[model samples]
Target: LLYALLHLSGFEDVSMEEVKNFRQWGSKTPGHPEFGHTAGVDATTGPLGQGISTATGFAQAERFLAAKYNREGFNIFDHYTYVICGDGDLMEGVSSEAASYAGLQKLDK
Candidate 1:
């Protein structure tokens, strides 16, 4: 699946390296969430709420990047985040914590 995505996204133009040979850390493609892990995946999310937390961080980062990069003419950072919380996610304490914070921050859309 990863190989297919890389190829579809024009990564073939850059390099055709295998993932296992990729370094453990500090490599562009780390074993996990190295930001440099892949061209697309913004953050490595394996844990229950890690993805949600990273998503919240990305939302915050987008706000900062928009201010830094997008001018009045370009509102590129305008977006929304949709999280589908299942029974499992609701049962997780981390998800509960994140949801509480989001509610306190009035982040509902």
Candidate 2:
């Protein structure tokens, strides 16, 4: 599903073939989406909690950039970071910790 979304976002390497070949050795669509290995992936994450932690980091970076560069009527860093997770992910302590930090920091975007 995510590989298809990446393809829809216009990343050429995430084409249908790669999506179909997911989890196969030598395929770009590994079980864990790697930053450099996949053209559109932004981080190298392992388990569910790790993915949330990485996303929180990205969101933190985005917030920092927005504060530093954004101005009235000229927003330079207005993009957002997004993620999806299952019930199992929420059960992880790391994910909860990352979520708590993001919430406390008000990293809504």
Candidate 1 lDDT, tens digit per residue, 1-109? 4434555677742244544445545444543443545675555556566666555656666667776888887887777764433575567778777777766766543
Runs in model 1 deviating more than 4 A are 1-35, 67-70, 82-86
Please estimate how well model 2 matches the true structure, expressed as its whole-model Cα lDDT: 0.88
* Candidate 2 structure quality by residue, lDDT tens digits, 38-97: 997888877868888888999999888888989999999988888867788889999999
Q: Looking at model 1, which ten-residue stretch has the lowest summed lDDT?
A: 12-21
Q: How do all models score by TM-score?
A: 0.50, 0.90
Whole-structure CA lDDT of model 1? 0.58
- Candidate 2 off by > 4 Å: none
Clashes of 2: 0
TM-score quality measure for candidate 2: 0.90
In model 2, how large is the Cα lDDT of residue 7? 90
